[model samples]
Target: MTNHQETIKQLIEQIGILSRKQEAFKYEIFELKNKLDQLQSSIDASDNVEKATLDQTDYVVKSEPIASGHREWIDSNVHDEATIKQPSFQHHKNQNSKVTHNTPQKSKKLSPFRKSNLEKFIGENLLNKMGILILVIGIGIGAKYSIENELISPLTRIVLGYLSAIGLLGFGIKLKKKYESYSAVLVSGAIVILYFITFFAYSFYELVPQTVAFAMMVLFTVFTIVASLNYNRQIIAHLGLVGAYAVPFLLSNDSGRVEVLFSYIAIINIGILIIAFKKYWKPLYYSAFGLTWLIYLSWFVMDYSNDSHFMLALSFLLLFYLTFYLTFLAYKLVKKEGFAATDIVMLLMNSFIFYGLGYAILNDNAIGEDYLGLFTLGNAVIHFIVAAIIYKKQLSDKKLFYLATALVLAFISIAIPVQLDGNWVTLLWTAQAALLFWLGTSKKISIYEKLSYPLIALAFISLIHDWSYNYDSYYHLEDNLITPLLNTSFLTSILFTTAIGFIVFLQRKGDFISSLKEGSTWLKIVSYAVPILFVFSLYYSFRLEIEAYWNQLFSLSELENKSISDYVVTVNDYSLRDFKIVWVINYTLLFLGVIGYLNYKKIKNIVLENSILVLTIISVVVFLTQGLYALSELRDAYIEPSIYYNRGSFYLIIRYISFAFLGFSILSLYRYIKKDDIHKGFKIAYDIILHITIVWVVSSELIHWLDLAGARDSYKLGLSILWGCLFFPFNRFRYFKE
Candidate 1:
């Protein structure tokens, strides 16, 4: 029995060991299978390409594989197109509800946090604390010094403040190197502040201050010199330095050899050279050169006070050199930086200077006799050289070589003696008109760029022509008066103005408002004032034009005779202020202003937008009521008590207002009737236009009946367009939105 039990135990032990080994083998096999499955999944995931459609703000992904080997077509939009072949038996076996879990793909766009950092760099602009601090201290300290010193007046201090503001000017220089930016700003700021405070604060029991002030001026001058040497802050440094230069020049007035002036020039020249050595230094060099030349010219004139002829010669040479050197620099800059605004400004200023010099040579016997044809001919050569250089570089910049060429031509057209009928200036004027028209319509240039120039030129021509005609006619006082285009006489100039005012009303577009906004506040006021003034000036002239002694009357303006400008007093027959004519002009202006109202309305088809239409209607009513009163006064002045119409064409202001008012009334009436507002009799919109017309008609009749006021020797105090809130003399504050 014992032997049988021992055999069973041995067999049991062996069987138990075998069973444990088999179970361990099964566990290892299961782990290996899991590892294989995981490896396969990872490879598939790595190989898969996520694809998407680009929306404006988001991506729409299509879970697809990027096609391999067709590399040219792949983008973020590629689709996953890989196919896998499984054995039929294995597929059938593994087809028991196969599960899928999605794996999210990494996106191409960065997270919000990363994007925020990127935006901070680009959007905030020069996140420079040091630069800003320097600017503030410079401006603040300069102001403090000026106020305390009273060395200068308020206007001058403000002007210098603008020029000396060198603090934030690092950006202007574009000093891109990191360490350079820091070192330059810090060192320069420290040196400048110390120099100014030490000098400006100079006083010794206030006794030695005169000497100290003189000494400080020298040291400050030196600092300005060194400041100009600074790569990024030349302009500001120049501003501070110029004040010192100006004080002595003003006191001396070219009488003595101002030694201080020569020192100033030397310092400025050094600054110019320093800036010139930079990788790109056109703007700085040009500015520096310009300042230096101006100073030199001023000194030359002063030193050669006896040698007016030599001074003129030297000035011509200096100016010529200035043109040549700047042109060289301009050509170089265009090559490096391509077409830029700097190129345009440099071109414009230099061209104008050259032309002005040419104009002097052409028109004035003084410069003409000295320079002969050199400024004109030499200017052309310089222009050609610039053109060749620009063309040779083959630059593809949009500013192109054409602007330089056009500017040169434009300048030449005016400055070159148009000896075509030997009536050199008349031909020049004709060419001016032609060129002005061309530039105004040219697609390449902007309206703001050259549009005003032509109009201004036209104004100058008219003024000159009228003044000359007046002199010639008044010398004869009757016979030499011949009406040219719209008759640009003292009387016809006003009427011509009214005609042009009508043109402006018609051409008025939506862009005008934007232009008004973008333009200088003063320019905006003037642009509107042109049309209004034309109307007023015409009415005044027209009423007086019909009066008896008017033909015998003469108003000799301070025309070409500039020496008479200061001595110009209000002489009886020749008062330039001539306010006695303002009232009838005001009345005629009111009578005719409806033209502007209509055209302004028509041009702004979207006048209703932002209630400009309502504003327009209100303005029209206000002015029209004023106009009625004006028309009555005009009749009293121009017409006989017994008869009706006067001699001569109806003043443009009157014609313009009548036609314009009728046009607007018809249009508004049509719109109102269509809206059924008029048929139902005067809603808010209908009544606005109706009231406007009523005011005009009633005022016109009443003025004819009552004759409220004539020639306003003391300005007529009334609801005249000149004084009203709507239209009179233009609202100087129109540029402000409020």
Candidate 2:
């Protein structure tokens, strides 16, 4: 009974182990089926050109149970990710075995690795291009040889060319499916040959009517385009376009029929535009754009006339511009693709080229130049509409959207200068610049902020032009009749100043600035150079205004009909010069005083602090050199005022006031330099400079006054008295004691 029980227990244990083996085998079968399914999918994608088969009779699966200890080793190896060999399956193939395996071998031509890159290039691209080129050259040589030998009539020659082209086309179409790339080369050659045949038939042989020849060539162009579309080849379309664009020039009779030429080019471009919308062939689109404009520009430069071709040229220019504009945006608006860098460049070129050509056309005509600004504004409106449409549609092409928005603003900014004259351009440009900056900061758009820079620069350029125009002695005497501060030029300068300063102010918000690297050149410009420009513009404008007022005052006094002010008096020209200089000096003092106040207020701007120190140094130098001389001249003139024009106390009071303001400006600088945060070394140097500058200015003023009162010969005595008076103040200071 015990022996029988042991036998039954061993049988049960064996059964349990066999059951686990069965589960493991089932899992292996599941994995094998999944791999087969994936292989089938790959074959389907390749059009089943390579077949794979798994025959039951060829592959034999065999399994054997392992001892428990060996199974334990296998399990441990699997956990350690070790490679363990399992039972093998035998695959066999024989005539009587009823099993066959098939995996189609890849052809050498189909496998790219079979050939080196040089061999492939020599076999594929170079050979095709060179062979076609050689064939075309051969045809030309043969035709020329035959013509020279009189072996064929012109009609026969033309007929032979057409037949050759037809034969090539037939061969290309036949071989297209099997040899698509070669077919493309053949088709391109055939199209070129057809174009030559058509041109010779019409222009050289006169064997065909012009209309018929044109229609035939157009048909040929259409066929080439269709073939390329079907074959998905851009090279064919490129060759076809080249042939199409060549037709007009090839058929040229020198009749100068630009209208017909432009019309034909327009038709060609329209087809290209259609292709752009249909396909993402950027090269084709750009070629069409470039070729169409090139043809138009060439004709305009070589043969265009204003009176004869003005309206016709205008129509065609607008048509071509609109076509390219639409085509450039087609991929974005229709296909919803983002703008590549080249796309943005082409778009910009299209716009500006059109504007420039249009401007030339308008400027050449009588009434058009007057409305050139309007034309520019019209362009701005068109782009604005485009931007609006893009925004409304909410297209995801952010680059294109930003570009469109920038274009609208750019056009508007440009139109100001193109349409308006003089200071009006500057004024409007500044306004636009401010608007762009505000939009940039508020909308968090960096492009707008960058664009604002150029507009502001343009405004500044325009402002300078106005200044030159207004202050030009020759021009001012004739054209400048407006008031000083209230004129358009001054207004333009103020607007420009405000706009740029506001841009600087907005930059302080750090919204637009953080996008820049901390120590970039542009950051330095905005931080340092921009503030200096502001101060310079302010100071220069005020100086010009003061000079302009005196100029207007004198010029109007000379005019009997013009009364600029109630106190217009005739004075010595020398006195007038001195008065102008004195007024400017006082204004400078006031300007410097205001700047010092800004520094004293602790604006915490490095540029401001440096500007004040630099300006103080400059002022000290000028006071010692030019300023003292000018002051003495004024005082001399004041002592000897013209009896006819006693422009009395204003001049004297201004001189004294200038001295007072100068002292105050220096004191402000001294206080700013003495601040605890300032470097002790900088403070010491600045204190010495300011003390010497103030003492020299005060003693000079007193000595000059005493000299004017007939103490000129006692100049040494005056110096001694002045030093004695200043010595008491210096002795009280701790630096003097040290």
Best by TM-score: 2
lDDT of each: 0.45, 0.73
* Residue-by-residue lDDT tens digits, candidate 2, 467-552: 88877652246465666688767777777888778877877665555344679998677566656667788788878888887766
Candidate 1, residue 72: how far the Cα is off, in Å: 41
Candidate 1 ranges with C-alpha deviation above 4 Å: 1-295, 305-334, 339-396, 400-406, 409-442, 447-476, 481-738
Weakest 10 consecutive residues of candidate 1 by summed lDDT? 60-69
Q: Residues 1-738, candidate 1, lDDT per residue (tens digit)?
A: 454455556656555445444434444443444344334433546774332321221222222111121222222112221121211211123555333436554676546866875875554334443564666576677677768887777556544543453343444344523244344454455445434443334331132244454555565556555555543344445444554544343233344444445554555455444434332334545665577557555544344333344445445544555544554454444323345676567666655554554444344455455454455555666666766776787543425556655555554554444322222343344444434434443443443334444544555454456445453454343465434322335444553444455444533533334222355885566556555554444544444433212333433222332245575443232221222233333433344444434544554333222133344455455445554444434444444332222323232245345535545544544443454323343344554565456445644543343443443333333336323644422234334513
Q: How accurate locally is residue 560 in candidate 1, as Cα lDDT from 0 to 100?
A: 32
